[model samples]
Target: MPALNAEKAIAQEKAIIINTESLNVRNGPGLSFSVAKQVHKGDEFQVVSSENDWYEIKLNSSKTGWVANWLVTLKAGSSAKKGTVTEDGLRVRDGAGTNYSVVAALNNGEEVSITEEQGNWYKISAGSIAGWVHKDYIAGDAPETEDSETVSNVQPDNWTGISTDNSLNVRNSPGLHGSIIGKLNKGDKVSVTGSVSGWFRIEFGGIEGWVSSQYIEKPSSASKPPANQVSYGKVIINSLNIRENANLNGKVVGSVKQGEVYEILEEKNNWYKLSLKGGKTGWAAGWYMEKTVAEKPQKQQSTRKAEEVQILYNGTNLRSSAFTNSAIVARASSGETFPIKKKTGEWYEVSLKNGQTGFVASWIVSVSGSSDSAPVNKPKSGGLKGKTILIDPGHGGRDSGTIGYRGTFEKDLTLSTSQILYDLLKKAGADVILTRNDDSYSSLNTRVALAHYHDSDAFISIHYDSISDSSVKGYTAYYYHQYQKELSQTVLGSLVKSLSSRNRGLKQGDYFVIRENKQPAVLLELGYLSNPSEEALTRTHSFQDMAARSIYNGLDEYFSE
Candidate 1:
């Protein structure tokens, strides 16, 4: 009866293979034993006995060897479980148990397709390594083999999506039990073809597979404009803020500089919806944008005698109206000459070589033998007259500072505003000195030193603020000392009144220029570049003019006090 029992046990023993590239077969169940032979991946052997983490196997008719349990898998199963390695460097052995020889290793989080199960072991194949792992270290569900004949015949759609999970399995069928064929990382885009149950049929890296619908997201419908529409608008502000919504408190997404042109989509309330380059869309205040007229084909020269005009600026917009806020038809570079049809107020109507007719700013063009138009200069205000003021425009050169969504640079805005303020202050008769007059770099210490050298009555540093949260918008004034706080408050209050933007209020800050300067110093965050609305507003000439006037008025008030 005992011999019969032993025969039955032997009959139940199954054939297995070296699942790794090379596996060592040893004479005993422990690492201390001598190696009997090396077997390559897919080499088959019969299981004879198991002890600890080692498997005693039959190599041939006359030999038996011990292999690490994790390195071998049962050769009979057509399906297995899907799992992932829980820990890094988990060893793959040549048998079902650890006492068997080591065959390979698995990195943490590595995915595997299980093929069979035995006792406390699961057979798996991860990439180039096929082996057995202890059930305690794997996390997965039972695997289901796919029958190609049973695949759904649903045709794919044109929708696209992105994977939301850090590690998502792509299976051959649309279910958790299906065989995993690939993997996707978080944010990976896929072409969704069909859907079944809660799974999406997708094409990833040229492989068609199924992923859970819960982990996919469709692209935003508003990210791009509809095809074939071609309406255009011009940015009227030096830096016009673009917002996600058409409201005063909407989040800022980007900014567009004065002279930039964009395609207009729709207008609502006081905002113009613009289709920006690179598949982006945003809304800007309609009050700051003007519709651009379509370019007309250049007309052939005829007997209607025309006057010659030369472009005076490097890049001057040729518009289709007599108004400064009109739509731009083309750009005329400095030294470019054109035939003038006539002049209206401050704009000159010109006929281009391309047969197009447009308007150029009268100030940016010179008519042959005509006297230059008088510049419209602002009148001087008396209160700030004779006060020595120091202006510091923050950031320059390689330090671009914050860049808004529409590519408006904080450094550029600062310089533009500072120059405007300098003009306004100088016109008011204040002795003013600028830390930087161009796109150049100056260290914080250098700015403070210049202020001291000038012995200025007040030092004001201009800057734009940026934050990770794009929703934040407003203007803030900062002072490092108690004596400067009142100045900060006065200036900030005037700014809020002038620009009509949110008042971020005054705060004591320890900026180097403000803290280190001996003279009364203040730093102003004109607006948030991260906020689309504020960014656009801050970049406008009207905003800059308002800001400059506010600062001048604040200085006037401070001196009067």
Candidate 2:
């Protein structure tokens, strides 16, 4: 049994309309704090959260600020949601607490309409009865219209399948109008409980849920990878969209660039669901991706002084000796990682998974560990090597940026991502300088001063965007000076190649740091933190690595030009 606790609960969906002719949004809840942004009368903003007599609202897609509650009118309550009872004998009360009278009792598998939510309780109505119940007993997700047409129920032969979407919604019923109770990530295995029309009812989040049949793939010996082995896919096209659904009508979620490799999660009609980085997954046209049958070598126990290496390109031939003329032992697939026993001239003597030794071209494969830990190919000393690069992690200390849907702080995300980018540039032999290494706050003027003081070759500011509209997503590049335009494009272009999110392209911005700096600079709005899905993706380590690698590659390309 769960109890109601207002302090720890997530903010409900709500908005506030500015009433005063002009209202100044402050940095904090009090009037003593500095103004963060300004909003005119009649302007409405989504309320992120509320404090004592103050409400936090979205100023833009990338930042948030606080406004006095007295100057704005709170909008109507949150929209209704459909729910299904997960437990039997759930008590429905007249109010939101145990002290209230019991109105009714709900059984498992019963459906209800959630009209309002208060703390840990939900005001639900089922048929004629209506009352409050503990939210823990009900599985509620997305909103849905009133169900009218009877869903056609059927029985299917297959009972097990893999989800083919990055985040496949699991509905309470069998149709698009059904209430969403959970989600399935790319390659998640599901056990079918029932079937209806074009949907399959499966056990999701320990509750009965339905998912589209089109994105579910049945397992088999021929199509499935070997036991304890994974599959990889190589993007053959210049660019490929990772859509929300497998069909062309689906919305674009992310993208993959040519020559990039990702692990295959599931396969559908002419489509392949790929595991990009971290927990992000999406479907790409299988025709544009070459399916590579390869897996990481099974864990080895023997004490061998060797570092792991992966083939960068598919169908690379493993030679008998260090020379190309040597007899071809085997062909390696893309994304397959192996251990290198020794390094020969222009070749790596690798130990294959099948207990065989062969030599592969060094240029075609990438070493796994850092420079000192592995035989990494060092930079040519002409690109980013020894270049003074300054990284500014936007917002810190009391000045947190945007607030995520899940209550994630924008300051924390920027700091962590900056650390990753800093390490990558440092490893590449660049003289990387960070505006603030920790949670301490630095004024915008101070940040810009670092660039001029160091004669920085490039200054890059990192931030995650947010806005009132959750639907708006993707990465954005901002630059003020004309010279910064090229730098913005170069960095953003490389970033789009590696990111799974949308390509928002570059735009002119007038921010204090980039506008005052004389050196080449660009501020990157990485992803929409306000969007629940994009926020989760940006917080992953793989996402951070991809961002850093792309920026480094972009700087390298810009210098080479």
Candidate 3:
């Protein structure tokens, strides 16, 4: 075969890295390629080419490599002034010119706080090290000292955190050399007092200390509502349960009566903290409550047109941006109306009752007095008739996934079952697409890209479970967010009812496919391949057919509702 020319297929565009963690720059456009360098969050690069979901990036005048497109944001304009280093071991000097003594060696993608500038040299700080770097290496906005915003020292209230790692050391200070005063085990609750840099100060077991914020499960700044933004939430569900914390596993504090309105304090991960009637506060699931419009003073009707739209789907997400991957700012229920500010492609920018702006999908809502609005009465067609579903088979190619006791390859089983599902859904008049048709290698990013490109209504990732304990045997469905919980429950319920297996019920999993997927996505763990009995049954075609039929029935029920 002739040598393949990779350079001929790239698009010239400017992009900025968005991944919070460091991303590797590879020699080629796939995972099989070797890592040439690394790029940190806030770094910018010129896109020299593109292949599938990967972009060939121009790191510098002498370096070029490929990076995953999902990790970067593509934009058209002048790049930001602040940025990160693109290559490892870049020298951080005491002065801007090359003659300056080296103060520190910065790693690839390391973030720097820029302060002053002198010609080609910029004064910056990486962690505790203050130094200057050459202008050619930086990637974001380089703002002058006077233009930069000062950091606020305001602390949050009633914040609780859970330790994610075992024997997490509690220190007296925020840095690594801080004195270790105590330790906390995994899942241990700590009352967070404040934060400094990337460290969180906590009071655990009466001992006040600091811990790396990365290992604690606390509400991020992005999840919190804007300051001084107050809104009222009307409880819609009968006896809505309120928890002491944001998660589902948090202790139940009390219950709110249906139709009772409460002042909303904040929002985190689709949960709202409400101030109850008795001076008590607790978190309530956002899906069960609707934002009630506060009674405004009566006034004469004005001639201004009411630019409003009503939600058509229950549990619809109101995102911070027009993209599905953006953080969900709030959740809305069916029949709730919001005034529109503008439109961006398939999303409508709307003003919420809380005085905040968010974007909602255009298809799931109907605009008042507009020709683009969907009919008030939904069509009677089968839910899956014209829906696009993306079926993803877990592992393939060089990856064998989990091996069963009966020598069954997980990749093979997943592909076989997905193929059957593809056929069945296709026969039902649904536009179904498979992530992989054969035993071919596909990256997780590729799978997600396929779902977005096809505008899929639902994404199902199929896989078999394996563990050291052979006695465990059950079917579990997993979802990442509250909005996806219904889909998971419906599918898992049908599978358990149709097949002879233990129903493990719905689980909140953090798997990549389900977590990163923009559409209603679920990962189904059919049965435990480690169990001898389950492995034998999973190898049979009857079980696969039954599972496919159950999923089909589940989709029908989910969409019909």
The numbered model that scores best in lDDT is 2
lDDT of each: 0.69, 0.72, 0.70
For model 2, how does the per-residue alpha-carbon lDDT over 378-404 read when each residue is reduced to its tens digit? 233378888889999987755556657
- Candidate 2 vs candidate 3: the lDDT winner is 2
Judged by whole-model lDDT over C-alpha atoms, candidate 2 comes out at 0.72
* Clash totals in order: 30, 3, 12
Please, what are the lDDT tens digits per residue for candidate 1 over residues 1-561? 001122222313566777767877888754335579989998888888766446778988999988766457665444544676755677887766655687899875678887775556777788788877775566675333322223465555768686676447777666654555656654445778887657778864345688878898897967643232234555645688899987657799999875355756665533568878688999887556544322211111122344667664467788879887889889977557788788887677889889989998654445564443222332323467787899998876544556664446788788878888898889988899988776666756567656654556788999888765678888889887776677778777777777677788888775557865556778998888877778767867678878888888788787776
Q: Looking at candidate 1, what is the lDDT of residue 255?
A: 91
Candidate no. 3 TM-score: 0.36
Number of the predicted model whose TM-score against the real structure is largest: 3
Candidate 3's error at 365, in angstroms?
21
TM-score of each: 0.34, 0.36, 0.36
lDDT per residue for candidate 3 within 317-408, as digits (tens), equals 99999998999999998557898999898889999999999999775655664544221233424688898899999877655566675445
TM-score of 2: 0.36
lDDT of 1 at 132: 72
